[model samples]
Target: MLCRILFAVAISLQRVEAVDPLVDVSYTRYQGTSLLNGITQWLGIRYAASPVGALRFQAPQDPPSDSSIQLANEHGLLCLATGASPMDNTTSEDCLFLDVYAPTNATSKSKLPVYFFIQGGAFNANSNANYNGSGLIKASGMNIVVVNFNYRVGPYGFLASKEVLAGGSVNNGLKDQRKALEWMQKYISRFGGDPQHVTMGGDSAGAASIALHLTAYGGRDDGLFHATAAESQSFASMLNVEESQYQYNNLVIRTGCIDEEDTLACLRSLNVTFLQKNNFNTPSPGAQVAPIAMYNPVIDNDLIQDYTYRAFEQGKFLHLPAIFGDDTNEGTIFTPKNTSTIGQSDTFLQSQFPALTFEHLRTINSLYPVAEQYPNSGKFWRQVSNAYGEQRYICPGIFISNAHARDSVSCNWNYHWNVIDPVSAAAGYGVSHTVETSAIWGPENVNGGAPASYSTTNSATVPVAQAYWTSFIRSFNPNTHRLPGTPEWGAWTLDGYQRLLFQTNATAMETVPDDQKKRCAYLSSIGVAIKQ
Candidate 1:
């Protein structure tokens, strides 16, 4: 009787195993020809490689079929890494793939808002695959699809020559973005994502790219995203065609490719290793001598007709909900090697700010005390921080934010993240640029070791940050009262004069006094020309 009972149990277990396979996925053919694989159990999705090869440099072609393939257990390849930064690992010319994460058991009938992210790397470094959307998606209880794909970086992506321009192809990286948006519009429905409620967002150069997209003619027609959140960088600081050409010519000369008739083709034909060894290996400031000389998006008349700053000023941007801001220490990342601290004496300020009168320097120094702390460092960091705050980051942030506020009917939100912690302290940089990225995407999403301070705060603030992001994605306004552990986000106005300040333990909604903000603004008006 015992043996008979055991046999019955074994048979029941076998039947249960057969009913649910190890990899639980549902596949459907999409875009008429391409395989659209959805991992229903895992709640992930990706596209199979397109069959077209040489046509790759051209626009993205439609997938041949709408049929689904089994996607139960595969992660897509990351874009090829071209720079010497320790953060990058995988890369490829054929890395035009994206991934999406949605609620399990969700169908077309259950549409959830989507957050589309564009990764930042100065248009030449980093890949989208490094970021994982699982935590954000799960924590927020929102259907989120994170698209990570490769647009051409370096010579392969952004080469503009007389021949290429005549052929009508410049800013191929931007073109890749357009194609991705097109893909999202046609197929997000399959993954239970709302096609019409997409929020486009990015950081650093990615932020600049979004700003460019907001002003691009093709971007206007893409009809993919309804809202935008640009972080850290803006089009106001973007280099124009003349500026780009000057940099391009210098790079060509540096790389010994000036003699080539077709610079783009020649650069592409060279081994990636040879290019990296000769150009990218060295640590250099600015765009000069960067490994990916030909990789910058150009101001082609068709897509980008004029300077982005000019476009925003002239009200050429799309009338969409927008949120943009920068951190307090944007220039710390690019601080030059020879920079020194300012002395307490009036004589030192005069030398540094030769353009300013002695009285002006005294007034500035009085407001921003340089010699009070770190006397040995000579208040160099403080002065530099103040200068960069006004000229590079604050000026542009305010200008663009104000522009969007005036031009668009949709709401605008501005933030000043002053969450300086021990991690940045360890790095000898305070509230540096790119510090907030881990908070946005979560610690696991970043590549390098985060500061020790990051671990302490991640448990509480990570969820809060993700909520703020997801809420913004679901609704253009980030002012949801439902977010736990934070005050409501308010509309940023020129008159009320407040900025949302994000910290590790608290989120403060405070009005920045006109006097404090204006000092930086005044300093910016003069310092920009001096730095240029």
Candidate 2:
């Protein structure tokens, strides 16, 4: 009798294992895979109709209706990029998919907080594949859900001209991000994610994307996301659409559509391969050796009406709780080498922002004069790196943090990521841009192995970083669920300028130094000349 009861229990366990992890949204069923790590993931789920043929260059459209049970086992193709990318071979114009990861035992009624991330590649090359959520799911103790998706990039996404704007659209990439957010609001509950409690986060260009959304449509609160976390945010020049017409004209001429009645229609009608081949053939006049980003967000007077600096100055942004900061040396990677002379450094700056006059350059040089004690990659490399980093990444982060503290009723948290890596320090990229990403996402998910110390000598930093980030995602405040023995992270206030310093075994709250504050103030004073 005891042997028979054991056999019955074994059969019951087998039956439980046979059930498939599936979800239904808007009549479409998705068969997901249950990872061995206790997380259930639905990959390559379509969020919008394919933007091909007539839909090319237009805003994202609703996905077509389907009742079939589609397999969500592998990632979809990445969106076509403007230049060489890590994974360009697997790209297509039809890419508009998102991935979702949740606890295996979660039900529709679980209503766990959602963390939606956007990947960055200078608004050109990169995809959601770089960020796998399995580790983050485990880090959260299988309590929260994680999501990431792809969007259009390059000329296909940011092309701006009267003809293109009138006939098709502009900023389609930003629109693509919006479409994915709308999809989450509509269907995340099926994956046990609470749409109403979503936290949007990103790094580099991804962080810049979040800043645009915060000020999009004149700070319109669309009820899409509740809070934000950004690292190395950038606020590039916001030129008028007409200023970029030269690039649009060059593209149309190269594609043999300049003579056509409607250039946008002609370009869209061409085959994807022919267009992709021609996308990189034409280069703007005096385009730098390490070329400046030509295709950028424009002043459309609709989605993006003005510069991000001006928008924040006018208090025109969502007053949501936020965690924003930058690395100690953001410009190390962006500044070009072999700039042995001050002339070369000045040329580089001019190439980045053409609107800067001689006087503006002089002011920038005076503000960031070469320091005697600074390390050298070039004669004036450190000076140029400091200037470029402040103009692009560092100041922009401070701008957002100050704006949040001054305008928002909700608390704002900021950090300075200075955790040193032996490999990076040896390579001269001291706490470079996006260096802390692996820690936030868990070192295991990084494409190549993460820094050796992340898993060995400095292993303790990983859990601490994850705890603060996930804590913010789960609750609006980061202090609520932080790990034991960690320092209390204080909110950023206008008077204090307090921010947390995230370092290995030495994390603590610190104040922004007075000198850096003066530099940021000078940059803000010349916002219009730089077009930021």
Candidate 3:
């Protein structure tokens, strides 16, 4: 399979005609291919230098000018991570690279829109190579240029501590993302993309990063991206730098960096292989506690000034026109099997969010009652997914959309991705996190991707989604730039907060008032009160 992928990429690069111009770098003519009929792709272009050696924990630096034409024939290395192993070849520390896909006809003068994407894995897994943008470029009829890059993940990306703060940036991976965006602004026009009209989008962790960018530094707009889209956006709520110091300390002690005068320097100098193995070899997460998920964006009062929902509720975010949503049953997979009893479930919730008081968790648990509250519900843990899902995925969508709506600036649109795939339906995962990404990205390449051939619903949703999204990238309104036959998608308003539900059922795909309102409201109450 690896050989086949490498072959495909190599073939694509070889097919490039000498007549096609190289991308706008001061180096060798890194010519790529017109791989697909109407689209061209330049793969694994480094946006930043290799983050190896002493540069491991530092923020990504700009890709320096080189005289050699760096052949971008294949995907970049998968950034080192733990818990979730590499989906493709060779994980390494030198993984800061991106790929660009555009219409074959595009040129510096074309000014086509840009769609920048980020992949998801709870800050622990996945990579840019896993999500090739061919499907998107094809879906958009080769009219847009799509960008995807690798960012540090797991401990390498998000671990925070006083030592880390005193040394380098917290959330190094997110800063990697920022650097990539800056790269786009500097060079995308060379590939016929309009950097000024860039729209950043993602699923799961990628979506969480998008949300953070929205609120980074009290909603500052550094002209990075004009709009955003997020699926299953993570709203884990920020852990103050000190709040996660225990994780940092544990890592320090385990890695034998403890007692070093310059602990951060010790961490930076440690062997990459040793650090990744130990720090990321976390215990498997139980149904309710995504303990390792805490190794994510920290509240450093810089990139993140406050908790996610708090930033939303308090009206601090980039306020870009955004389209955000979550999956139906977002918690089925995240909900652990061990917490069958209500007591165990409560314990799990408290352990996950230590800041929430027992009294608060108890009241919240009552709202998501166990014991077949709904006539067809099964075990307590099954039902417990309701609260867990609401707390983690579903409500955060509502929270941010509400926050965007309150601004009354951009016409924020929200969505609910309940689209079922054959694989998920077979496993009873039911419209879980990242299901829509497959359809949007097309088939066969991504994890849980659209199959070799799309199903009936995928056929319906793909064009609709691509058209809707690319249209938004072109013009901030999903309705205005819609495909000829695309359905009307309205804005999510504070009073009329409706979501476009993408599902297998025909009627289920239209705009409707959010069904998770009450649960999301309860989540808001807790988040607002506890300030999570």
Candidate 4:
């Protein structure tokens, strides 16, 4: 009779568990609350989407306090679609949620370091949900909390119009970032993260955004992050407002949504499919579907008060330890094979940029030695790389490194990822943009076959890379005796021009000649030297 009773109770419990619609999570400030199933784990707490309706276009309002209803567990709908990237397709406008991945065993007394990742996709592609922080969280060994939040992207996030400005909407994307950081400041401790020991980091456009945040408004809220890691993007390397506005206006015109008096509203009301279909194309010749042209954060007066490079040059980055670097062949990702054949002659070069004299073109070519090395490669590949490198990576990185070096309170370490995957040779490119991300997070989790391309030598390179990165995350210094092997990370100096070069054979130190470095620097300064 007792055995029979236990069996019946087991059946009842199984049925109840199957029918339970939500999961409950308890936070220090809030009591037990049910959340939408999958979303709860991602956030590690219950959170509701902002309820501010039309005020959604305005700065993000605080999440409502609800004691009764279970916050939905599934991921919030991503913001309205801006393009056809994988991130845009999976997300919805209700996507203003933050995921906190902390050490599962951590406690309130455990003050773990925090890594606040800003996702990249030119501010129009990608989302926080796309990143799985489990590897990074575990690799660091420290109680590391990974926070990923959705910020408005595309028109909703970066619309710059007279009406929107009049209505007080400027840099909505940046404002969203600020609010997310503020939320972390107020609540991260509850999840075992040390708000005081926060390290802000990101890749590609995300890295650019971090750079913007650092230089914006006297590095507002300097207390938020103790260190910054900008991967493959920098302020000096990004588009200024003038350049960005031209592309934005072209996109606005192409989308055919100009009929409405309120462009932001019209954009919001349109079906996600229609907006994406009309506006979807690889904007520049070699660019991805969403390149620097289609969508990006603008230098609006409020969020980005001045040119990001100028801010860095003026020593405005709150004197934080900084780690900044780029892939050796960042441009190859976008460069195609046919570009060189099509524009091999001086006639083609001059025709493309009629304003440029033969002398000017030669001067530009002399600076980018890779063009000479692969003269037959293509005009689009060679010339464009030189131009983009100047506008995006080379100049800005050197400038920021120089600035940080001069700012006594700041320590700067620079790297050039020279390790090229032999497998990627099938694609006829060297180490491309975003190749290092797999190493930083770990190899297996990287999407598709992307990580597989990183050769055996490349795979072996992971430990050193991981050690360097986690060391930075743990102490805000990439240099530590803890790193394996004998090579030591040295401070970059204007005189020595020393930078760490990560190659397949070995991780070693090299001193770049001031002249060669200056040539590379001049190439980056082509259009924006005065601006910096």
Question: Which of the numbered candidates is closest to the native, going by highest TM-score?
Answer: 2
Q: Which pairs of residues clash in candidate 3, taking residues 3 or more apart in a chain or in different chains?
A: 28-69, 214-318, 219-317, 287-335, 287-336
Give per-model TM-scores: 0.76, 0.92, 0.89, 0.79
lDDT at 391 for candidate 2?
A: 82
lDDT of 2 by residue, 182-218 (tens): 9999999888888878889998888989999999999
335-443: candidate 3 lDDT, tens digit per residue: 6655567777776666556567767777787777763332233367556666777788788888888887787755688888766677665554566766777667765
Candidate 2's C-alpha runs over 4 A off are 1-20, 85-87, 127-130, 281-290, 371-376
Model 1 agreement with the true structure over 1-532: per-residue lDDT tens digits: 3222322332232111111122212334322111233223222234333412333334445544434444434444454444543333455555566656555545564456678887777666544444666656665553454454445555445645564454336677677777777777776666666677678888876787787888897336567787888778633233335444544454466678879986655555555555544434221223223221224666667788766656676788786777787786765555432346444333333332234555556566665554223323434565655554455456666766777767644377888777767656555457776567777777776655344466675446666677777667655666551376578877677666567888767778877667657775665455433321
* Clashes within 3 Å, all models in order: 19, 0, 5, 15
lDDT of 3 at 48: 86
lDDT of 3 at 87: 37
lDDT (0 to 1) per candidate:
0.57, 0.81, 0.72, 0.60
State which candidate, 2 or 4, has the greater TM-score.
Answer: 2
Off by over 4 Å in 1: 1-77, 80-82, 85-89, 218-221, 235-237, 240-243, 246-263, 276-295, 341-379, 408-410, 447-449, 519-532
Largest lDDT belongs to which candidate?
2
Candidate 3 accuracy as lDDT: 0.72
Candidate 1: lDDT of 290? 25
For candidate 4, the 10 contiguous residues with the lowest summed lDDT are 12-21
Error of 3 at 368 (Å): 1.2
How many angstroms is residue 105 displaced in model 1 relative to the true structure, after the best TM-score fit? Answer: 1.7
